[model samples]
Target: MSLALPLQRTEVLVIGAGPAGSAAARQLARAGFDVLLVDQQPQGRDKICGDGLIPDAHKALARLGLLEQVMALAQPVSHVGCIAPRGGRIDVPGELAVLPRRELDNLLCQAAQDAGARFLAPARFEKPLVNEQGRVCGAQVRIGDDVHEIACDWLLLATGAVPKALIAAEMCERHTPSGVALRGYVHAPSMVGRIKAMEVVWNKAVRPGYGWIFPAPNDCFNIGVGVTDSHKAVSGKGSKKELNLRAIFDAFCANYEPAAALMREGKLLGELKGAPLRCTLDGARWSRPGLLVTGEAAGSTYSFTGEGIGKAMETGMLAADAIIQGKAKQWNDAQLREAYEQSLRALKPKFDLYQRANRVNAAPWLADLLIWRAKRSPRLLARMSGVLRETSNPGNLVSLKGFSRLFLE
Candidate 1:
């Protein structure tokens, strides 16, 4: 059963008030646009994530003037320790930060509100309202029992991966090698002293992707595993019911003596949540006249490190800039698409190349070899770190001279 509704108007409508949507709304509102941000969840909603923000992510937030607020709630991480399946450890010196997604998202939304963007939380989005020509004019939203049609000049979809509305409208195509991420927060006994670092352990049992233990504030930590669906099928892990993440954590603790000691004193703080990870670059279509998509809705996440915060912020900012310029100039779909694609190319090539390399080197033996080489050679380590940080151009991959210099010299 469907009901027709009267129309409301706004200058800009941003869907999904996550990091990407909030960032876009904040920038657009600061630029003097009347931005209306909407999300299905209520305020202070929690998201499932490792909550580890790398230094580059901090840099992006600093540009948006939200660094101080984020720092206030975040726990500093000064090192990243990795344990290989072959039983060797490598410690890298760098700064990272962690905070629960609840705090971070709330802070970002507050910032958006302060910048003059109106928010409609707990507002369920039914679908995009497409014009006769198929250009999205706004969205059909349900607030409580009533459905309202919102009119806008532009619609930005910052909705994350599971955007059923967009998929139903045939605006997005799904592709991949999808995977499952199981995450939870727990209290563990202080191992390796204080909780100032994030630890990644690559064990045989954790295939395709790795397991991570990231320190959160107040002696709490986020523990998670990312494993491809195909890997799970091959491993004969029955079904999701039989392969619960909490059980996997217990198994890991049992197998690893050090981890076992930590769990003995640790408390299981909450219910574990499972989320899907799209492993391929599937959704690349961005604009159709009045419609534009950014962040995970556009597949801006890097498949390699599972890091989307920085990329989402970057894309959101670029989208705002493009929208402002396009609206002012009355640009067409081709023009907007060109601008958006250029923005993605500018901000994404290095990270995309890194993801490609990771997919190519998916085998544990190859990963072990690369890690060993990186650990042994300072220059290689620096180059790898630079790639990870997205501070270098991926064009270096095509340059024979640069490749030789990086790996051999």
Candidate 2:
């Protein structure tokens, strides 16, 4: 594709209107750059997520200057209810809230537009346009039946999880998804006030996976299950990993009483939906000449909690910062890529710890151990809360040292 007589030109083209893309676009546009934010779907599209915003998310929202606004629209909660196999339960205190993606994403996208970024809807990225020098100069975007070449100095791919967009950009390193998740909203008025915390449930029946019930605004409960291969599934050594997400979801609804109670008392708002997750910060090449990958396209989700909203926004801001700094400092593309990748390197250890924490999902008994210890030891419970705050390491709660600390410390 050629950029000759291109009708659209932007200094930065951010694909996808999710938290990451919107956040990046907002910052770039606020900095007085020509930014164009596009997404295949129209505004307010429902994204598959647990809808729980923990402390880490709070901090990110605060930095975006949207914490107060989001909290006003969110279901503010003080704790996360963690349930173990055999039904042991504990509420870990932290800064937490629930807001549906349908609302949260649109709020961020609108914020980007308000910040002077041009926004386009129903725009799909077909493929990148590479210059003669092998640098990405633009992309071909499909809108309805017509396709247009959009020229840009930099492209940030924030298209989450689905690999087709990544493949088109040659950014997809692995075709296999890091994990899969299922979720649905149920309108349970009776349970709305009753279920206070964002509840996470672990059990053997959903090995390599877990379940959650987050109370949202308007008496809606977000309930779901997920299976991830951050480390290994309960599947034996060298075994092919296959998953039936629906079956696992069904198993979760059956074995977990909270999910069952919610479903029985409330009607499902829509069908249970599933989406793939790219995790471990290992799904794609971080950067190339004139282009950078962020968000779930860069594998931003955590394997342990399937939490990515905050990290997605963080990486988006990081990407915007890289471009801004590169322009101001007159740095080369290599420097731009290095700065972004190094920033991610600082975050990769946390992603690793989250992946290590996935072992508890595989071995549900570990949850029982932690809950058992946490109930007796306020110190242990505080550490778990610190994990939500990103002040403590998640791996410590699941490691051998973690296990020893249950008895010793």
Q: TM-score, each model? A: 0.87, 0.96
Give the root-mean-square deviation of each candidate in angstroms: 4.7, 3.2
- The residue pairs in collision within model 1 are none
| lDDT at residue 136 of model 2 (Cα atoms) | 96
After TM-score superposition, the amount by which residue 57's alpha carbon in candidate 1 deviates from its true location, in angstroms, is 1.3
Winner by lDDT: 2
Clashing pairs in 2: none
lDDT, candidate 2, at 82: 94
Candidate 2 has its poorest 10 consecutive residues by lDDT at 231-240
Q: For each of the candidates, give the backbone clash count.
A: 0, 0
Per-residue lDDT over 1-409 for candidate 2, one digit per residue giving the tens place of the 0 to 100 score = 1223338898999999999999999999989999999999998898999988887788888888889989999998889999999788889999889999999998999989899998888889999999999999999998878899999999999999888988898887777678889999999998877789989999988888998899899889999998888323232212227678889888988998778889899999979998888888986889999999999999999988999999999999999999999999999999999999999999999999998998898889999989988999999999999899899999989888888888986
Instruction: Find the number of clashing residue pairs for candidate 2.
Output: 0
